[model samples]
Target: MHNLNAIVVGAGMGGLTAGIALQQAGYTVELYDRVKQLRPAGAAISLWSNGVKVLNRLGLGKAVADIGGQMDRMAYYSSTGETLTEFSLQPLIQDVGQRPYPMARTDLQALLLNRFGAEHLRLDSTCVGIEQDEHSVTAIFEDGHRATGDVLIAADGTRSRLRSEVLGAPIERNYVGYVNWNGLVDAREDLAPKDSWVTYVGDHKRASIMPIGGDRFYFFFDVPLPKGTASQPDLYREELSQFFKGWASPVQLLIQRLDPQTTNRIEIHDIDPLPRLIRGRVALIGDAAHGTAPDLGQGGCQAMEDALVLTNYLQTTNISVEDALSRYQTARLDRVADIIKRARKRSDVTHGKNPETTKQWYANLKHEDGRDIMSAIAHTILSGPLN
Candidate 1:
C-alpha cells in the first residue's frame, strides 16, 4: 500500500499514456497489465496529428519519429483505381500543430514503456475488482493481490472490466457485420511509393495501405463476411484472395503475397456514444470511453488526446479529484461522442447494402474540400476545458 497516488489499469496505449502524463504531473503512478510481457499484439496504426501533438509535448516525439514513417498525403480512390481526392497533410499539420505518423503498435508501446521504466509497470496483475470512496481507490487483482491509490483510471479498453464494474455491463458490443484483415507486407518493387496513405473504396469493401518503417507496408481490408466466420490457417490466403479477386490494380498482387501466418483478422465492434465517461473517483479513457469505427483512424488518437486533456485539467485546476473527473467528462464527452457518431455514419455509408449509394456518397465527398472539416475536428480535439 502506497500513499496518495494514481493507479492505472491496463498497459495498453491509453493506460501507458495516462501513466506518463500523471507521473510528469508529480503524481505517484503504477501501471498494471495481465499479460506477462508487453509485446506488439496486433499490427500497425496511424498516429494522427492530435496524437503526435501530445507526444511531442511529452518529449517523446523524436523518439517515436525514429520508429515511424511520415505520411505526406492521404489519397482516396475509387474501386477501379481512379483517384477521387488528395490532400496535402504537411500544411494541415502546420496549421494544427502536429504531424501524423504511421508506426507499428509495438513501436509506440515500447517507446512509452521505455520512458516509464520497468519498475513502474506490474505485469500479470489483472484488476478484477475495484473499491472507491471520495478520497481513495482500492484495486483487487485476479491473483488476489490488492493495491490502493488516490485515483483509479480505467483505461482497460472497449471491453474494460472497470467500465463494466462502474456502469454495469455495457448494453452489448455492436458488431458492424464486417471483419478487417490486416498485416504488414514487404512492399513489392512496383508497389513501393513514397510517404502516402492510399485507400481503395469499393461497393461494400475497402482497403488501405500506409508506409510503416523500413520497406514494409502496413495494410488492412474491410470485407463483408458473415458474423463469427471462423478463420483457418490453410484458408487464410485463399479467403482474402477470393474476397478481393479482380477488384482492382494491386489488390490481386497484395493478396497473393500476403502470408496468412503473419496476418490477423478482427471483427469490428463499436458502441452508441455515451453522454458521460466519469463516475465517482473512477474515470474512463480510450476505447473504454469511446469505441468508434476506424473510418477516421481517430481511435488511438482520440485516446491519446483524452489522456492529454485529462492531465492538463489536473494540472490547471486546483480542484478536488471528483471535480477534476467531472470537468474531464464535461469537456471530453461531446467531442468524442460526435466522433463516434461520425465514425458510425461513415461506416454505414461505406458498407451500406447498396453499392451504387456508396459510390455516389463517395463522389459527393470528393467534391467537398475537406480542409474546413478537418480544421473543425482539430479545434475540438485541441481546445479542451481551456475553452
Candidate 2:
C-alpha cells in the first residue's frame, strides 16, 4: 500500500464511490458532505451496463443487483396510446456482458454509503475553500475547521464551490429547455409493466415510468418550458396533469399515482465541458468535472466511471499524486465531453429545440426496431474504460 491519505468533498454518488475505491487501494479516505442527512436529488438513476461494471469492480456487484430494478424490456407509445415499438433488452445485455439496473436513488445511495462506511464520513460540514502546498492539500470548512490530506478531490457536485477555485471562475450551467417532475410509486401493471420500462411521447413532452426495486416504479414527466419557471410546493400533480393532458392511460395514471408532495420538480441543465479536470493535487469528478443533461441517462454512470478511472491511475501507476491526476484528466476529458455533447444534442431534439429534427425523430420511432437502439447502447457500454 502506498502512503497516501485523501480528502473527499461531497457525499454524493461520485464521492462515495471515490472513497470506497481509494480505500480499497489502501488509501485513508475522509468524506465530508454539506447535508445533515443525505437526500437524493432525483427519484432514481438508470445504472447502465457501464455503471454496473464499475460497481462490480468495487465488489458491490451482488448487493446492487439485488437492490436494482429488473428492467429487461423497453417500450414506447404515441400520444394516442398506439405502441411505437417494444423490445427486450436481452440482446444488449448479451452484447455488453452486463445488464442495466434502474434503481431508486435512495437505495443506491444507501448501498454506497454503507459500503463507504458512515463512520468515516462527516455530515453537515460545508466546504468553504481549500489550501494546498507542495506536499499536501487542506480543505477548509464553513465552520472554520480544516482537514488536510495527501490530495483533495472536489466531487462536490455541479455547483461545487471548489470548482470556482480550480477553474478561476464560477461556471454557469446551461438550461436544457425543459422542466422535469420525477417521483416513485408502487409498481402496477396498469401504470406500466412490472418489469418493463415504458414511455409516452408527444407534443414536445414525454411521460416515462421504469420499474425499480422493492416492487415500485420510478416515474418522470418532461415538458419543454422556459427557464426560471415558477413553482409552488405540492403543485406537481396539478402541473403535470395540465402539461400531460390528453396523453395515454399509463401516462395519466403515472401522473395521478405519484405523490405531489414527495415529487421533485427541476429545470434540467448541463454545463459545457471544462477545459481541464485537474489542478495540481486537486481534481474534479462527476458533475463537477463534466455535468451533462440526463437525456441518455449517463450522468451517474459517467460519474462512477470517473471514480474508477481516478482510482486506477492513483493505484496502478506508482506515479506522483500530481502526475496521476494529470493522467486521469488526459484519460477522461475527451470521452466525457463527447458524452455530454451527445446528451445535449439528444435533449435538444427531444424538447423540440429543432422542431424539424424532433418531428423526424417522432416519425422514426414508429419504425425503429429495438436493434438500433440496443446497438447504440451496446456501443456506449463497450467504449467505457471497463471494457
Candidate 3:
C-alpha cells in the first residue's frame, strides 16, 4: 500500500469514482460534499462504452448492467413524425465490446455511494478554501473545520471555488443560449419505443427519450432561450406543452404525461478549457477541469475517464506526487479540450444556430448507413486510456 492519504471535495460522480479508484489503489481516501443529502444534479447520464470500461475496472460491472437500461436501437425523427433515420446499435456495441447504459443519475450515485461505503463520506461540508505546504494540502470548510492530506483533489464541480485560487482568477462559464428541462417518466409503449433511444428534432428544438432501468424513460427538452431565465417549476408541464405544441404525437403525449414535481429546469452552461489542471499538490478533475455542454453526452463519461487516468498515473509512476499530477494534466488537457470544442459545435448544430449546417446534417443522415456515426463513436471510446 502507498503511504498516502487523499482528500476529495464534492461527492458527485467524478469525486466518488476518484475516491473508489484511489482506495483500490491503496491510498486512504476521504470524501466531502456540500450538500446535506446526496442527490443527483441531473436526471440521468448516458454512460458510454468508455465510461463503462472504467466502472468495470472498479469492480462494478455486473451491478451497473443490472441497473442500466438496455438500449438496442437509436432513431431520429422530424418534428412532424417523419422518420429521418434509424439504425441498430448492435454494430457499435460489438465494436466497443460493451453497451451504453442510460442510467438515472440518482441510481448511479447510490450505486457509487454503496460501493464506496457511506461512512467515508462527509456531508454538508462546503469547502471554502484550500492551502498546501511542501508536504501536505489542507481543505478549509465553511464550518470552521479543516482536513489535511498528502494531496487534495477539487472535484467540486464547474463552479469550483478552488479552481479560482489555483488559476489566480475567477473563470466565467459560457452560456450556450439555451435551456434544458429534463425528467424521468414511467415508460409507456404508446409514447415511445421502449427499447430504443429516440430523438425528435425541428425548429431549433429537440426532445429525446431513452429507456432507463426500472421500467421508465429518461426524457429531455432543449430549446434556445436567453440565459438566466428563471425556471418555473410549477409550470413545467404547461411550458413544455407550449414549446412542443403541434409537434409529433409522441412528444405531445410525453409532455402531457410528465409530472412537474419530478422535473428539473436549468440553463445550460460550460467553462472554457483551462490552460492547466493542476497546481502544487492539488489537482482539478471532472467538471472543475473541463466542463462541457451535454450535446455529445460525454460530460459524465469524461469525468469517469479522468478518475481512471488520474489513478493510473499515480499508481504506475514512481515519480513524486507533483510529477504524477503534472503528467496527468499533460495527458488530459488536450483530449478534454477537443471534447469541449466538439460538444459546443454539436450544441450549435442541434439547436439550429447554423441553419445551413443543420440542414446538411439532416440531409446526410438520409443516405448514410449507421457506419459513419458508429465509427465516430467508436473512435471516441477507443481513444480513452483504458482501451
**Deviation (Å) of 83 in candidate 3:** 0.6
State each model's CA lDDT, in order: 0.79, 0.90, 0.90
Decoy 3 TM-score against native = 0.98
Off by over 4 Å in 3: none
Candidate with better TM-score, 1 vs 2 = 2
- True-structure lDDT of candidate 1: 0.79
> Mind giving the per-residue lDDT tens digits that candidate 1 earns over 23-122?
8888899889888988764688888777877888888978877888867777777777777777777667777666778888878898899887879999
The TM-score measured for candidate 2 stands at 0.98
**What ranges in model 1 sit over 4 Å off?**
1-4, 353-356, 365-387
Best-to-worst order by lDDT is 2, 3, 1
Error of 3 at 317 (Å): 1.5
Regarding lDDT, does 1 or 2 come out ahead?
Answer: 2
* Ranked candidates, highest TM-score first: 2, 3, 1
User: TM-score for every candidate vs. truth?
Assistant: 0.92, 0.98, 0.98
